[model samples]
Target: MAVLHPRVAPRRSTTRATTWWGKAWVRAVEEAAFSESDLVTARTLARGGHVGQITTRPGGFFASVEDQHGLWTVDGAIPELDETGTETVVEAVAAEAGRIAALLGGDLPHDLVEHTDEAGVELLPFGSELAATCTCEAWAEPCVHALAVLQQLAWLIEADPMVLLQLRGLAREDLLGRLHARRESPVSDDERDLDAAVEAALYAARLLDDPLS
Candidate 1:
């Protein structure tokens, strides 16, 4: 079973909320909660970058984000496979997500800018078919609303890394296909015999433990 960490609530602030971005973030969160397929997508897109398209109008900013089956946050960071070499995928995605969070929090290192196609830009995969892009334009990298969405995503990611993988175009089916192909490949007779023997031994062991044995 997976253990979930308890979330620490944010400290309340009493200062007058007058910043334009701040207000926009608040509105974005509220609208996202009602409109998003899930909390993850709502939060990530709310953080604000280029994960999708953002259209600004006289009324306000309208964002059109790709929906990855409604999963969000760090969960979006998880890949679908758990085979060897897949850890690299998870780490890369996490590193990217972390960079985005750091930029948003004003803690990003200057040297890291080169990794991104554009300076201070962060792109996060939402799922196998979707992603969220964050451009560090404001003092708050993603702004407050975007940060709020990210906070939620972090929690989800910590819980399950698969969400990130699916966002990066690698799904469970992809992993299984790779595994099946590897197993079916031609091999020496000795190697094949050894493999068969191992399977037979495992089956015999299971039979021994069975109540019907």
Candidate 2:
């Protein structure tokens, strides 16, 4: 014979719902193009927390979270991946965004915020948009769901943060740094010689047109 208590089942369900990883997975799938489910699988990674607020701006979107660490922007795009890996997926997205920016010949949209004290590590757009902010000292960094989202982002960043960057039309490389590097590697002396030859011809014309002559 078996006996089941009426309250026991609901409590178990509630417990499962509130578990750190459980909540995170729920939040993560909710952000993506996937349906909610009880099972945790490759498609159902965890999200750290809920989105606090989201506002659409003229060209893009703006979001805010209450996590202790801020976002950090890196200096360049991530390298390509070997297969259809998560990292590869993110880098592909970023590369597309950069291509779009280049086609438009306009400034790519981007923002860099310090979500944490770590160097070159950032909260990233996916994490920022999906994980809501919190002022509490839960020490989860983000809440459970946020932690899940962060885990997913970790996977994503391991492959490519540039995918996040591309969404904003900014690549991982700094525009100024690229410009500086270009300046430092200008055309060689052979090109300068060609320019001097052209300048000499122009000067000869100027001499021929002297007023005294």
Candidate 3:
């Protein structure tokens, strides 16, 4: 599990998610929300520092949020991929050297997601696929508190797409382990060389970007 401190308020902006995957997360919850007013209020709560520390783990996240009523606990979950689904996603990632390189470099490859989706493993949640329950007595399936937590979650996702992968059931280490095992399986020397080259390129790019590091 990882803990995320409350976000410092940012300058006014209409955009909540800057990354493609982060935007997809927000869209999922927005489509599930029944009340537009709640969404508006939730956005305000999320941006104004009404939300407290958030805790995340495989398949779920929770946080404390304050509204007009009071402070409330919000727990949200996106269903984890089953064992078969996990393997399918892993296989998809392992098959593409670029996907592994991108992930190692803290980037999510769009084509990797497309491949997984084509393989029937929806890496990103959709609609009510993301569900939440709040301690607030609100009748809405996802009260303002829950929505606020989710909106904050999108901010975290923007910084690290791996958050989505973990929420979907595969942690970073576990995913990498599976990929390593697949690579260790019977394969041609050329394939190994290609994987090594991709990793070398990623490392070189990082050094060039921040020589001080």
Candidate 4:
């Protein structure tokens, strides 16, 4: 579990996502409209630094937020990738060594999320794919508190792309482990060895006297 506090609490006028991926998350929230008023309240709560500790789980995440009534707890869910989907994730990660290296270094490339399509997986939420529940008595499908949590979660993913995949049901450690395994697979090793031998042969051939010439 990790915790994120708003570096600068949001303001009513702060109406944009800091990262492109973060913008996508904000768009998803906008798609599920209840009342614009509720949205305003949510963003206000976010910018005011009223949100609390956020904890991650297998298929979702949770956090608390303070509203006029009291402190409210919220639960967020993201659809998990299945076994076949997991295979796609592994294949994509294996295809790009730099992706894993960046993740290992705690940086996620801005384009990393785009590779999910090649893997036939969806790391980011689609339309109403992100769902939220709150203990607060706001009857909107996604109450104000829920939106606050989503906003914070988006910021979390911007800092670490691993969090996005984790919501898709792939743990960071497990995903990295699988990527490493594929990178070290026998096929890749054989290819590397063959390339090395070819390069060596060429280098040696070049050194020979120009008898053929």
> Number of the top candidate by TM-score?
3
CA RMSD per model (angstroms) = 16.0, 20.6, 4.2, 11.6
Against the reference, the lDDT scores of all candidates come to 0.34, 0.31, 0.79, 0.70
Task: Show the lowest summed lDDT stretch of 10 residues, model 4.
Answer: 193-202
| Pairs that clash in candidate 4 | 10-47
Q: Per-residue CA lDDT of candidate 1, range 146-194, in tens?
A: 4344434333333333322333344433423332333454366643543
| TM agreement with the true structure for every prediction | 0.28, 0.23, 0.84, 0.77
Clashes of each: 26, 32, 0, 1
lDDT of 2 by residue, 1-213 (tens): 111111111111222233232344335434542323322321232322322232321113222333345532111112222223323333322333243233223222232122121233332333234423334344432343333333333333333333334333343333222322333333666334433433443455457679464
Worst 10 residues of 3 by lDDT: 2-11
Is candidate 3 or 4 superior in TM-score? 3
Ranking by TM-score: 3, 4, 1, 2
- State residue 139's C-alpha deviation in candidate 2, in Å: 9.6
Better of 2 and 4 by lDDT: 4
Model 2 lDDT at residue 101: 34
Per-residue lDDT tens digits of candidate 3, residues 29-74? Answer: 7997878998998898888878888887888888888877788998
Candidate 4 residue lDDT tens string, 84-165: 9887876665555465656644565655656766656776677588788899777886888988777777777777767777
- What TM-score would candidate 3 get against the native? 0.84
Runs in model 4 deviating more than 4 A are 1-15, 105-112, 186-213
